[model samples]
Target: MTTDLTAFAHSVFEAQPFSRFLAAELTDVGPDSAEIRVRNRPELQQQHGFLHGGVISYLADNALTFAGGLALGGDALTAEYKINYSRPAIGETAVARAFALTTTRRQAVCQCTVHMLGDGEERLVAVAQGTIVVAAKD
Candidate 1:
């Protein structure tokens, strides 16, 4: 990613208060892909002591949107998405990786996978697919 684009992505991310509260990091934003990482915290866990499903979903959603936005080369918003949780997220950190699967003039289809990283290994926790459309300009 170009330095300008990287700055733009970070600025957009920093504008989200919820993401900041979660301590999420926009680790990478590229032409066709994006990545997000969040450190595990007790407040983010559920009854079973695993990362809450909402947290996993948030990571996937943001990653997919970022990928689509990058593919579109401008602002974009998620149209809709579906996610499947394969396993509990149990790790020191969670990582979401997303890529644009297809793109048109105004929209892109994106896929995302969320993983739990711990002890030198990563385990799949969730998968998601979403459609993103260019944001309407003011």
Candidate 2:
């Protein structure tokens, strides 16, 4: 049976309570790729008045996992990941773009970049790489 992956992706995003609480919108999800966005707010900022590192990492991880699932045509979970923050994420919004860089039957390498969008421009904020493991069907 074929799945309507776009609908599935939206459902997955909606089911996540944290994402909902973060006010993240899953803008796009296709085979091997996905994008998410969140509006910047003071609550999401750190002591330095910039987007918190945890928030940035959260965006990358979820976006990458979604891309991995799209690539595998099934559910996937993050095995491990690493991220590097290049600058303070300060902007009116944050966008995360993720792609499945490589895929096997059961594993995928997902990469993501996050950008801060404000004042009609975007600034690169963080980069992440993750390994996602596709779960076997029950």
Candidate 3:
């Protein structure tokens, strides 16, 4: 099931042009959680040499939706989200881990934490909470 879920997550991640461009990888996906990781690069940094806040936010939002989808049993979209930065993200890679906090038939409340990994350690960079709704069938 883990392999299947990870494959499903990868396929969905691959379909997003922006995510693909960022070289984001869906490292894990399970019954109520998901994780994404992206390597740091020059283009993804800001003037201060920290990972851009927008990039962190993107990871948080996407991870939250993926976790919600796992809990809800289908694809999900972020209805809304709020993020708080704890520190500048200075690292070789950024990882986002998310889990469903609560779930109902139509939606899930999820939380995520973004971490910066480098120097044999991880630093908490940001945290987020969001509402994710079932995606409309196309």
Candidate 4:
């Protein structure tokens, strides 16, 4: 299959105004998966000196949305999503990986795992699952 998940991620990232604010980068993408990384900049830090939960959640959502788009091979929109935080993310970079778990004519189900990388180890920070609604092509 001629799946260009990376291209789809880049397009989605570029289309979102807030994505630029997050400074997220699409590091890896495949037929049914995508990964994103965001540096721990000063602006992204919270009061306790850890990355904010919103930032990580945004990254995770984007990754999952992109993965769903790749699976459907069409325009998609997030129907619903839920995220659970496991720990505070205190690291130099936050990484999110997402994959499509299932797909139907109108919806795609995706899962995303977010991790904080620091001290040479990656710690699970959050996880999310979402449904993306795909629209018919013109």
Candidate 3 wrong stretches, greater than 4 Å: 1-5
Return whichever of 3 and 4 wins on TM-score. 3
Write the residue-wise lDDT of candidate 3 on 1-138 in tens digits.
466766776788889998988999888888989999999999999999999999999999999999998888877899999999999999999999999999999999999999999999999999999999999988
lDDT of each: 0.94, 0.93, 0.93, 0.86
Candidate 2 RMSD to the real structure: 1.8
lDDT of 2 by residue, 44-74 (tens): 9999999999999999999999999999987
lDDT tens digits, residue span 45-133, model 4: 88998899989889888888888887887577788999999999988899999999998877889999999998999999999999987
Expressed as tens digits, the lDDT of each residue in 11-62 for candidate 1 is: 9899999999999999988998999999999999999999999999999999
Best by TM-score: 1
Each candidate's clash count: 0, 0, 0, 0
In model 2, residue pairs whose N, Cα or C atoms come closer than 3 Å (at least 3 residues apart or on different chains), thus clashing, are none
- Give TM-scores for every candidate, taking all chains together and pairing residue i with residue i: 0.97, 0.95, 0.95, 0.90
Indicate the TM-score of model 2.
0.95
